[model samples]
Every structure is written in C-alpha cells, then in structure tokens.
Target: MFKGFLTLRPSCEVCGLDYSFADPADGPAFFVICFACIPSVALAVWLEVAFEAPYWVHAFTTLPFMLLTCIPPLRPLKGWLVASQYFYKAEEGKLVRLETPRNDDLHPHSA
Candidate 1:
C-alpha cells in the first residue's frame, strides 16, 4: 500500500504475491473520466438550463456532485478494470502476418 502508486510492481495485500501481470495502464482512469465526467456534466447542464439555477447553486452542487461521482468510483472502477484484465488475460494487440497467399494471386492470368 505504501508503494502501490509509486511502483508498477506492487504486491497483493492479502496474498502477498507479486502483481507483475497487472498492467491496466490508464484504462481505468480513462473509463472513470469518460463515464463519470460525461454524465455528471450533462446532468449539471441540464439541471442548470431546466431549472434556471443560479451560478452559486450550480457551483456548490454540481462540482461537489461531480467530485463525488468520480472520486469514489474511481478506485473500484480501476480495480474492476484491472481485475478484469487479469481475469481475461488481456493483452495489447499484435500485428499478424499471413502465412499463405491466395491461389488467385499466383494464377491471376492463368484463367
């Protein structure tokens, strides 16, 4: 826990095992921002426009609500994403090569 954020090679708290394979990268952060920020902002805008709320009301309510929505869920979302990655053995996509060529390519003019 002390060095979890500082190092990529953090260990499991319960099992005390190495977590070398847990490389979710920025995926969790990206998800949190996309899902949480979008909806919060959208709702905030809607509420402001619909109710004609004042600037102070928007400032006090919307910002804190946005923070609440994003901050609390971030850790769990990141954990879930990382855990899902590990559970599924997810990896980066690699370039594939064709092992054989089509017969039409070789016999283009034979017909």
Candidate 2:
C-alpha cells in the first residue's frame, strides 16, 4: 500500500486519518541495524570457533550468512515499524505551553 523512503500514499485505508503522522524516519533501518549486530557478531565468533578456519575462510564464511541475515527482513521490518507508527499515532513532540514571561510581566515594578 505504501511506497518510497518517505510516504507515497497520502491517506489511510480504514481510519481516514492523514498519512503524515506515519513518518517513521529511518526507524525500520535503525531497528534492522540494531538487530543485525547481534547475530553478525555471534556468527563471526561461531565461525572462528567451530571451523577453526583461517582469516580468508572467515571472510568467505561470514559474507554469505551476513547477506542471508541482513537482507531478508529489511522490508518487513520497515513495514511493521510504519504500521506501528500509524496505529499508535506516533509523532513529534508538541509545545504544550510557553512559560517564558513577557517583558512587562518580568518588570512589573518598572511598569
């Protein structure tokens, strides 16, 4: 339904809410990167231990598995994060009240 790095669509299907609030802004990629680190480190360690292979073998061994682990979940992770944003009404923070006093208020004796 959605497309592009930013949103391609302009509105919602079910709630009729505007799609602007759904801006996840790298959230999915961030999540994928955070997740990828764990397994990649583990894979590197495991390959070193299990195979007792040399450095060249480590490159060959880890490369394919890195691709296998990193590439597949990207789209789905992005979709889930976007969907979560939409359903939960996630958005930038708002200015509820500006409490700074006016010049007159600050210098009431002068006034």
Candidate 3:
C-alpha cells in the first residue's frame, strides 16, 4: 500500500481497498528508534568509550549504520501494522455509559 519510500498510496491497486484507516503514525519510527537507533547509539558510545573515536568517525560509521538500519525497515513495518489492524478490524474505543437507577426510581409509592 505504498507509492514511495515512505508515502502511502490512496488505495490498493489489486484489491482496491481504501487505506484511509491505515494511520500508523509514528509507529514505524518508534519501532525503528527503539530497535535500530538504540543499538547504533550503543555502538557509538562503545566506540567513544573504548577508542575515543572522533566526530568524523561517528559521521562516517555510526551515522550510515544508523540510517541503514533505521530507514530500510520502516515501510515494511508500517505495512505489517496496517495489515494487522485491517485483519483485526481495529478502531478507536467508544465510551458507552449505562444508566443506573436512582433511589427514588427504585421505590415508587402509590398515592
């Protein structure tokens, strides 16, 4: 359900399914940050602590590694989440209030 690297198509080409409900906003990015960026950051920290690597080292190694690990999987992750939502028919929760009987309603006196 994607048209570009991170852009979604309006509808599915084969099934013609509307993608309006597929709002995986920040989910993919959050996963990437948690799974990929954290490790890359740890690598950077290790490099700094062990070898005292300079900024250029991070710019060359850590940055590219982080980008490669973080960027590539976002689209597929988003698609998987969207498909899961569709399969499960997930939607926003609605607040439903039930009426409770008052004490006066419980006791009705015949006049």
Best of the candidates, TM-score: 3
| Model 3 agreement with the true structure over 1-111: per-residue lDDT tens digits | 899788889999999999887888889999999999999999999999999999999999999999999999899999998998899888877999999998778887832
lDDT of 2: 0.74
Give one clash count per candidate, in the order shown. Answer: 0, 0, 0
Best by lDDT: 3
Looking at model 3, residue 81 earns an lDDT score of 87
lDDT of 1 by residue, 23-74 (tens): 7677767887898899889978998889989989889989998988887776
TM-score winner between 1 and 2, please give it.
Answer: 1
Score candidate 2 by TM-score against the native. 0.62
lDDT digits (tens) for residues 1-111 of candidate 2: 466644446766776767666666777667767888578878899878887879888678787777777777777776687688868878888889878989999889995
Off by over 4 Å in 2: 2-18, 49-51, 98-111
Q: Which should have the higher lDDT, number 2 or number 3?
A: 3
Write down the lDDT that model 3 would get: 0.91
TM-score for each candidate, following the candidate numbering:
0.72, 0.62, 0.86
Arrange candidates by TM-score, highest first: which order? 3, 1, 2
**At residue 101, what lDDT does model 3 achieve?**
93
Score residue 95 of candidate 1 by CA lDDT. 94
